[model samples]
Every structure is written in C-alpha cells, then in structure tokens.
Target: MERQKRTTIYDIALKLNLAASSVSRALSNSSKINAETKALVLKTAVEMNYQHNAMASNLRKGSNPTIGVVVPRINQDYFSNVIAGIEEVTYSRGYSLIICQSNEQHAREVDCVNALVNQHVSCVIISIAAETGTYGHLQQVLDRQIGLIQFDRVVDELDTFKVINNNETASLEAVSHLIEQGYRRIALLEGPQQLDIFRQRKAGYLAALRQHNIPVLEELMYENAWTKELGAVATAKLLDLENPPDAIFASTSDFSALGVLEVAANKGIQIPKELGICGYSNEPFTELTSPSITTIDQYSFKMGKTIAELYFEQTEGKAQIKPKTISIKPKLIVRKSTRRK
Candidate 1:
C-alpha cells in the first residue's frame, strides 16, 4: 500500500517545534499569527507539497468563498470590465467568481439568478436584462439572505443595494450641450422606456429641451432603438422627414450612436454642421470614430469596484443595517460629434 500524505499542519508544527495552534492560525491566515511565522508556514507548506483542503476549510467556515455574477451580455466591453474589477477584489480575498450571461432575456435572467442562489453564493451581483422589469427573481435572492448587488442596468422597483449612474442628470447635460451647440431640431434614439435608466434618460432629454424652450416633438422620439441596427433604421425614418432633426441624442449606447453616424454619413449629411450626434456608455470606439462621438462616462469599472466594496461592507457587518442603495453620478464626455462651433 502507498504511504499516506502526512504533511498536515500538525506535522509541520511538530517538525518546526512550534505550537499546533500557531501553525493552524498561520495556515488559516489569522491576524493573531506573526507575519514572519505565517510566511514561513506558507513557504514550508509549498515546499512540503501540502495541498489545502478547501472543502474542509469551507465546511469549517460555513462559506464556499464564491460570488455569482449575472449580466445581459458578457461580450460587451462594459460588462467584461465590470467583471474584471469584481474578480480583482474577490480573488485577493480568496473568493471564486461564477459568471452567467442572460442574453437579454427575462426567463434566462430568472434562471441564472435562481441557479446562483441554489449554489449558495456569498453574493450575487447583477445588471438586469433589458427585458427584465420584474423583481421576483431578485426578491428570491433577498429571501435566501444572499447578498444582492445591482449595477448599471437595474430594476427600479427593487429596493435593494444598487450601483447606478446618474442617467437622468447625464442625459440632461448631454442634451443641454447639444442645444448650446446651436442644434435646435434635436431627435432622440431612445431605449425601452420600461427600464428606469432609459426612462430617466428620456426625462432628462425632455427636461433639457424644455429648459432651452424647444418644442417637444413626439414624432422625433423613437423608442426601442437600443441597438445599432435599430438606431440606423430610426435614423433613416427621422432623416426622411420633410423637416429632419438637426441633432440626435443616441441615448441607448455608443453602438446606437455609431449607427446614427453611419446613416448620416451615407446620407452625405455633415456632422455638427447639419447632423450633430451624441451617444451613451462612452465605449472605446467612440473616440476613434471619424468625428468622434460625444457620450456619457459612467465610470464603469469603478462602478464595479463600488459594487464589490458594497458587498464586502455589508458582509463585513458595517452599520448593522439592511439592504442599501448607492448611486454613482455619471459624467458627460463631450466630443466633436456634438460640436457645432
């Protein structure tokens, strides 16, 4: 029979002539253990080829040290960067991350959240699907006592911990900037109004127009154009009008703004001179565009860091409080696309 692996913490303690408790504490990363001793124990464990028993440790600690994240589309740069920030924090804390994509479907979002809860994840961070207007699935996570944190695209009905950009204010500022650039007849490439982010952004657009004494043209606002294809279609329709809009606010995202730019370019309309444009989400490609796209910077990765910190804060027993909401203000990044002067 093969000899059993005998390099346990106890064996290390005996070999080093140290107390068993000290060895255990060092292995467990307890603050009580001296830094040098902890380093020595870790180094010795590696040299001795001692594999950590994660299952036993988890059983002792009553946690699997994993966090589950759900998002609409992971292929998007914004979502990927957010996950990168989350992983950065959780990995340092010896926690694992499980990611799921909802494909912008309500049913899929529900299933993803349920699966994470079933896995007993210490926390669940999500950006609700565009099709998700209900909160029953999220409420289920709350009932299970698993920490729930929402970021970016979120459901407004849920009174849980949230990390969102100031969509309304940012939209207002973006629209106001366009107005100041002498674009009087402005159009909007809006998204699903059911989502609070879109609704607030629309409200901001309306507020800015009202502030500037511009008439609200119901015909100029096209809803559900949240993608480049839809934005291109909407642009064709808007520009075909007997009186085309002088400016377009692509409030859906930069991809939508790109669609607007493409349509304008194809139509031989000059940007900022005849057809000014702006977009949201501040994607990397925004600056690379011919005229460059004006957009809003939501500090996406920092938003992810804020969400992760919120999870640690709640789990760390800060304030003895219940679920909380934290809102991050978004800033408008002006580019040449909206410049008229």
Candidate 2:
C-alpha cells in the first residue's frame, strides 16, 4: 500500500493564502509572528494533522535535545521511579527521552548502548545490568563522545558522572539494626557479586558482623540470591541447616525478602519471633505484607531527578567537564518484620 503524504507548512500556507515562511514562523511561535496569525496556524495545523519535525529542526540547530536511558528492568519500582524522575526534568527542559531495558543481560546491555550511540542522543544514562562483566561497552559510549551518566549499579573504574547510593553503609545499618534487635545469627541473601552495588552491600554486612564481634559465618551468607525464587530456595536451604539463622537479610531487594517471608511461613516460622527479616528497596508491597517487611528507602525519585539535573549541569556552557560522583544515602525503614525488640 502507498503511504499517505504528511501535511507540511506549504500545505497550510496554500490553504490560508499566506507565504510558507509566514506559516513556518507562526508554527514555531516566533515573536515576529502576530498572535492572531500564530493561533490561526496552530488551529489549521491541528485540523490538517500537521506534525512538526522536531528531529529535523534539532539537527539544523546542532542539538539532539534527547536523552537515552538504559535500565536493567523497566517494571521494577526502583528503576521506574528513577525513569519517572528523569522524565519530569527532561519534559520541563523541552527534552525527549529514549528508554531501553537490558533485562539484566550483558550482551543486551551492550546492544542498547550501541543503539543509543547510533541515534546520536545528546546524553545516555544507565544502571548497568547484573550480568555485565566489563566496562568496554561503557567506554565505547565515551569514545563516541556522547555524554554518559551512570546511576545505581555502576562501574567504579569508569571516569563518568555517577549517581549512586551508599549501599555498604545502608547494608551495615540494616544488619546492625537486626543485631540490636537480638538476632545473633543473621543470614545474608546477596545479589550477583559482579555488580559493584552487591559487593558494597556484602562488605557492609561483613563490617557490621565484625563491629559486633560476630564471627563471619560463610555458610550463612548466600550468593546470587537477588530474586524472589532464589531468595526462597536459599531460605529453604538455610532453614534446613543444623544451626539455622534466627534472622535473614535479603540485601538485594524487597522481592527477595518476600520470598524469605513465604518460605518461613510455609515452615510455620513466625516472623520477628522466630525469623526476623529485612530487605532492601522499600517497594510499595513491603508495607502491605503479612508482617510489614523492614527495608531501605533509596529515595529513587529524588535520585532520578538528581541524575537529570547533573546531566544538565554538565552540559551547561557547552564545555567539557570533569567527571564526578554524587552519592545519595539510603534510609532504613523499621517495620514488624524486624521489630523483634
């Protein structure tokens, strides 16, 4: 089938008996165009289904005015809140956004980055995937001279604008809270160690144990237990141990904590009373659970806004800027799940 021709300024000019230049100025809201002419042009354009070619105009101005965002998962609350925050700022600045999800796959993440680069986006914001192994793909973004901002899960070696949470400190606080509540044997459900965030969280867990004179029991620490299913399976195995942990900290996410809660409930284990639980990322469902789960609030929306603001600041004056890192501290939310005291 043949494609329908798009409405253009020339068509509107011909219909209105005006010069094409007049129609262009009116549609652009140029100050030179009178209000009456501008209003008439806008109305006629709407009626005629005229679509302004922003990309073509942006190209003429040597600016894209579009930001690309890549995340591990679009459905997760944390990432969604961040993207929403980014959109809020970008929209206000008359900038557009191109969002992509890597689904936690390294190869897919590389493809996403490359695609954004090919589009010649003004900037790229990303939270690296869990399976990402090297910084080469990120470096390629820099090689293309595209502005790059890394948030949440980031690469430490890369010299780029970074926005991150103090994961280790937050984890230390959560573990310490569990200990203060009288949970001596605390089990940790860690995410993939390849990601720096997970490594920092694990470090915090170990530090908390050392501070309280608690021995670091390797058996109690589970690896790659970042998801609900993995958390459930790990919980089952931990509970079957000869000397099981009295408390479990799903340091990856609230979803993991939910898995722990389910497994414990199935075994007739009472939360707080028998198995104190804590999770990271204070997702909405955390508060509505059977026993509200204690978790960390990363201020995801604020973090997202900060990321956008930082990008704008860097691009200001159109001069090359030095790389910087901005760390946002996360807060611990106490709830029935870990209020054993």
Question: Which parts of model 2 have CA positions greater than 4 angstroms off?
Answer: 7-50, 317-320
Candidate 2 local lDDT, 1-341, one digit each (tens): 99989999999999999999999999888999999999999999999999999887787777899999999999999999999999999999999999999999999999999999888899999999998988798999898888999999999889999999999999999999999999999999999998999999999999999999999999999999999999999999999999999999999999999999999999999989999999999999999999999999999999999999999998885786789999999999999999976
Candidate 1 matches the true fold with a TM-score of: 0.84
How much is 114 displaced in model 2, in angstroms?
2.0
Q: Give the Å shift of residue 39 in candidate 1.
A: 19
- lDDT of all predictions: 0.88, 0.95
Q: How many residue pairs clash in each candidate?
A: 0, 0
Candidate 1 — which residues are off by over 4 angstroms?
1-56
